[model samples]
Target: MTAAKHIELMSVEDYLAREELALEKSEYLGGYVYAMAGARNAHNLVATRLLVELSKRLEGGPCSAWNSDTKVRVRTNGYTYLYYPDASVVCDPNPGADVYHDRPVLVAEVLSPSTRRSDEGEKRIIYSQLPSMKLYLLLEQDECRVTVYRRTAEAFDLEAYSGLDSVIPLPELGIELPLEPLYRGIENA
Candidate 1:
């Protein structure tokens, strides 16, 4: 007979404490910590471009754009999840914790092959639980494509944009992001 493996879970306090001194970044979900993988050049380029654009557009506004180093806290189904999105915009910043943002108006993830499933499935579902989140973006690294989820009175509205000439209108934050600049210098993107 095959033996079942036992998984030891870490507490939220311990996880936070460890993260304070850890050399690398890891996401906390429930009671488990998942190590983050290093991003590729394409991923970095895409994420950086998005961050730059968001920062420029959000300047002098209530919302501020943050890089991947900023963690977002989401609580749902009796579990606390701390995710490091590729880029995030928070109009209402949490004053209690400097390391994480509890209320983010927009969250963006540059999709990669290694993390596509979780980003599209698990992360998407969990992020929706945040009442402050109004927009979610899934940007493709290898192509000029983006999947946008905008919150409505009833539910989230899904939209997809492709091609370099396409533009994404984010009226929630009063910003319009063009795909040409986002995928600039990215070959075949």
Candidate 2:
């Protein structure tokens, strides 16, 4: 029976402006902004290992790997979203001067207890919507496990690998990540 609440929806420009001054990174979806959670040691270690490996392998090539701070802009069904993956690889020769990357060939997320559901569900759906995404990796921080979603002609195929001997191959980037090295610094606590 009371008057409905009215709130001003934040535009992408407004979000970008706040991002510069804010202490922490946030994800913008449509008109809502959500603060990012801090990562634990295992999460950071895994993400760093992957980023370092990808960066080392992609050196001097047309492709480049980025850390989690790089934002990826996605527009799906009339809604604009800005998300930061744990690691991303962009193969574009001339990516325009934007604060976010829209043409990432690979996006990887190191799964934590706080982000598992959203990463596996919402993020999986959104990242796949991008035509430039060739591979999406979800890595477990507690164990040596990886879930890869590879894009085919019209859909994505799922693959899982575990143990220290498995190697994840990404033909798109002409590189392979061995499970041992990726999980080298992580420890169970």
Candidate 3:
């Protein structure tokens, strides 16, 4: 008979402390930690562009744009999930800790082939659960395509934008992102 392998889990506090001193970033889900994969050039470019645009438009405002290094903490009935989104905007920053933000007004993920499933499926569902989250963006790195989820009274409304001329209107943040600049310098996008 084959023996079953044992898996150990780390507490949230331990994970946070270790993550601070770790060389590479990792995401925490419940009691398990998963290593994060490095993003490609196109993914990096798209994330940077979105952050830059958001920062420019939100200068001196209450909200601030954060890079992927910052983690978003999601608490459910039975579990806690910490994810590092490509870019996130927080209007009401959490004063308790600098490591993670619990309330984010907007979160964006640059889609890659490897992360497409999680980004669109699990991440999307969990991110929408945040009461403060008003918008979610899924940006395509290899193409000028964006999937926007805007929060409505009852539920989230889905919108799609494609082509360089298309503009993503984020009334929640009072900013509009032009697709041309977002996909700029991305070869074959």
Candidate 4:
């Protein structure tokens, strides 16, 4: 559960073979595996809602929606192998070996207390390096907040939103998300 426990020498295949039955979330470090904690009900609920809405909207588009079970491999030269995101959308349908993509057009992470900082920090940094990544999104499990990053020629621009009626326009996928369906069953709902 600490820095020392994370091993950095296991091959991607070896890591997968060892922890295939893991009940909780597990991250594949360069060569070792680390157990990931569970997300709260709100976190999982929102992730489900977002995926549902995204799937419905992206049905006929070229992009495909991937739930968390997919593992994302961020190209690390030789430093590290993969880093998983909660949800992702890819323009390509024929992603090889990896179901989770490093070339994703868009990636979404549902925030939990333990991972909010990582999703915003280390994970964000790792994702930014992907050439095909266009938008990186953070979904709030504690509130109705959503932060989006769009790739521009010079840099990735940031757009943050809250409450209902704030539309998330995913141009590549030709879809827009309104807050209504995303925050469907919270206490305030």
Q: How close is every model to the real structure, measured as TM-score?
A: 0.95, 0.94, 0.94, 0.88
lDDT of 2 at 185: 48
Clashing pairs in 2: none
Each prediction's Cα lDDT score?
Answer: 0.94, 0.90, 0.92, 0.80
lDDT of 1 by residue, 1-189 (tens): 999999999987888899999999999999999999999999999999999999999999899999999999998889999999999999999885678999999999999999999999999999999999999999999899999999999999999999999999999999999999899778776
Stretches > 4 Å off in candidate 2: 93-97
| Cα shift from native, residue 186, model 3 (Å) | 2.0
Where is the poorest 10-residue window by lDDT in model 3?
180-189
Q: In angstroms, how far off is 178's CA in candidate 2?
A: 0.7
Candidate 2 global CA lDDT score: 0.90
Candidate 3: tens digits of C-alpha lDDT, residues 69-112: 89999998778999999999999998856799999999999999
Candidate 4 accuracy as TM-score: 0.88
Using lDDT as the measure, which candidate wins?
A: 1
Q: Which parts of model 1 have CA positions greater than 4 angstroms off?
A: 1-6
Error of 2 at 143 (Å): 0.3
Q: For candidate 2, write residues 18-92 as lDDT tens digits.
A: 998999999998889999999998889889988988999889888999888889888999999999999999987
